[model samples]
Target chain A: MNKIEVCFSPELIHLHELQGKIVVVVDIFRATTTMVAALANGIEEISTFADLEECRRMKSQGFLIGGERNGQTVSGFDLGNSPVAFIKNEYSGQKLAMTTTNGTLAISKSANADEILIGAFPNLSATIAYIQKHRKDVLIHCAGWKGRFNLEDSLYAGALVKSLESSHEADEDGALAMKSLFEKEGHQLKGYLGQASHAKRLQNHGIEADIDFCLTLDLYDIVGKVENEKVKAVIKP
Target chain B: MNKIEVCFSPELIHLHELQGKIVVVVDIFRATTTMVAALANGIEEISTFADLEECRRMKSQGFLIGGERNGQTVSGFDLGNSPVAFIKNEYSGQKLAMTTTNGTLAISKSANADEILIGAFPNLSATIAYIQKHRKDVLIHCAGWKGRFNLEDSLYAGALVKSLESSHEADEDGALAMKSLFEKEGHQLKGYLGQASHAKRLQNHGIEADIDFCLTLDLYDIVGKVENEKVKAVIKP
Candidate 1:
């Protein structure tokens, strides 16, 4: 059986051996959710940058720039880190250059992984399907809030672990804890995740809709794969 | 309300601000449990060293030396990391110099905190009462398996958060997650923690008794406080 593990925060990423693992990078509050939404709605590809200046630089090359810092949109960026913003297909066929406080940094830090997949509740099923197909050791890398553990991403990891339990064995206590967390609270995703610190942070910014939307499961039947630093949609077979 | 937070592992200690906080350093499988047991059973004071050599050298000074590496006793140490070994008061009235793979390292790293307390399930209520009496911001620093996240320590953290819930607010997602975990599995702690990676590690070495002893609640009514680099038992008022 393939092994599944969880790295609760990007700060703890160094402790994980990523060389031959398929890392499912999750930022459930918005970043990975937004990527899935953007790709599912016809955005050609999503390129993530850890630096706002680097993401903004792509605007001159016709890429739609999206950046957020501390849960707010960068002053001059075309979009904030919101999945709802990408749902209308308004930027269909465009390439997105995005940066966020946690998600993009996690993606960049996971460069050594054998394969990187963007994971969120919206794309959870597809992400599991992809992992099941590949049968590689999996690491769910949660882009926690500013290098601290967060609830939403870990819940997403738990959901994935539960789904993949038949074929994959949870490799450590982190995975077991998350799997148990999801089992207990998975049914009330919105209500449970709404209590998360990151949820409260976003709620304080008056984005309850984004939090609700981000917790919606299986909305997109596509997997987001990081290829050459760009996230592209992988439709289910 | 006072704040309660959990640092899931020593490796992630750098991300947490330890100053002015009371850190409850826990190694549920053995180290802290051993300390609590040793102090409760009449050991004079316990000094922790991260280096086995330093611990070994203390023997020449008439201190009882206990050391472990990777779940086994280090060669030539006076005792392995076992609470049972200390329970008989075999080394009563003697100072203990100890080193272990994770617990000692966690205590050493948490020296920046205002107050350092050794925590274990055996003293769960006492630890809670001590925290309530102090009413300071608390950080439950789990001495996870070699700087990685582990179940037993986090569960102990969760138990503290839950018991202190009325007076303390969870400071972040880590604390909140642990609180929920404890609430969900607190009653069945032995069965729940028996599945932990570290528990399995110890069980493989034929120390199932230690695992049971470590998970037992309220085995002693003492809080081990670190002062001048020594853990001296603080009896409950």
Candidate 2:
């Protein structure tokens, strides 16, 4: 049996053993969704940085710099953390330097995993189909807002588990509870996601479109995996 | 407003400042349930211990001892981690020494709180009613298994949120998410809890009654709170 464990927040990522597991990092409010949209719309390389200085330094070397804090665009950067900003075909073949409040930090922390995939509602099916091909111990690592548990990330986790075509028994109470939430609220996800604190934060900044774009299901047929610290598309076997 | 934040595990305990907050400790599988039961059935005091040696020292000094590890009773202790064991008239004036895997550890971690109330399904209504009277910032500290998020605790966290009669709202997505899970699963809790991994652990040890007793809503009229490091009943005004 391919057992699944859902790590609800990155703050306690150390409690999970990621070394040999297939880790799928989900940051549904923005980062992972934007990464998928960028790749599908044709950005060649998206290098994730946990530190703004390092991400800015890469920008000086010719990468399109994109970073944000608390939903607003980072000063002196090309983009704010929004999937809407990434949904353009003009950015194809560009190497991008990316950083965000939570998602990139989650990616940096899961550096020990054997295979790391970026998961969000937009690219969920592709991500799930790719991982299902390989029978490995799976852990859904949620990049919760600033080291605390958040709804959108957990909702994404539950949706992923429910999306699986496996026998579908959750490994523990956390997994079981998440699976239940997704099943009940998965129908009106927009109504639910829109109520999230992070969603409200983005909405407060006048960016409800970002939340809407992030919640769009299966927008891209791309499965994103981490390689050399940059997230890029990989073909399904 | 009584702002509520539900801290899902001890790993995220540091993210919550307990200094002036009213922290409600939840470990529904046994510890908090047993504490409420012991106090409700009339034991004078139940001193919790995170360290086995500390709990054992009290046992050696003529206090009645009860301990559990991985859902089984600890060796040489008078009782296992069952709330039913405490529902007796004979233990009315005796003090108790308790050390468990998760619940006691949660109490030890929240030693800095202004007030620490023992929360479980047994004391659910009383705990909620007592906290609403004192408009302090509330944190529902869940004793997750081995520093990871667990379903039963999150379910209890949700139940507490839904039971609150206050006009206050949840502070973050975590609180909202927990509240959603509790309201949805609060009805078929026995079926839901029976599906949990921790419940299975107890069942494997032939302790189904513990699960039933833990799931009982508001079994006790008194709220168990920590003062002077000892758990005792407090009346609601």
CA RMSD for every model? 1.6, 2.1
* Fnat per predicted structure, each in turn: 0.58, 0.77
Model 2 lDDT per residue over B57-89, tens place = 897677889887766678888887789997766
DockQ of 2: 0.75
lDDT of each: 0.89, 0.84
Report the poorest 10 consecutive residues by lDDT, candidate 2 chain B.
B163-172
Model 2: per-residue Cα lDDT over A80-174, one tens digit each? 77778877676777888888758877898898999999998888888788877887777889999789888999998898787773834477666
* DockQ, model 1, C-alpha based: 0.70
lDDT of 1 by residue, A160-225 (tens): 999999989985899999998888888898888878888988999999989888988888889999
- lDDT tens per residue, model 1, B130-216: 889997999999988867889999999999999999989985899988888888888899998888887887889999999889998
For model 2, chain A alone compared with the true chain A gives a TM-score of: 0.95
Please give the clash total of every predicted structure, in order: 0, 0
Chain A: TM-score in each candidate? 0.96, 0.95
Would you estimate the TM-scores of all the predictions? 0.97, 0.95
lDDT winner:
1
Model 1 lDDT on a 0 to 1 scale: 0.89
Query: What TM-score does chain B get in every candidate?
Result: 0.96, 0.94
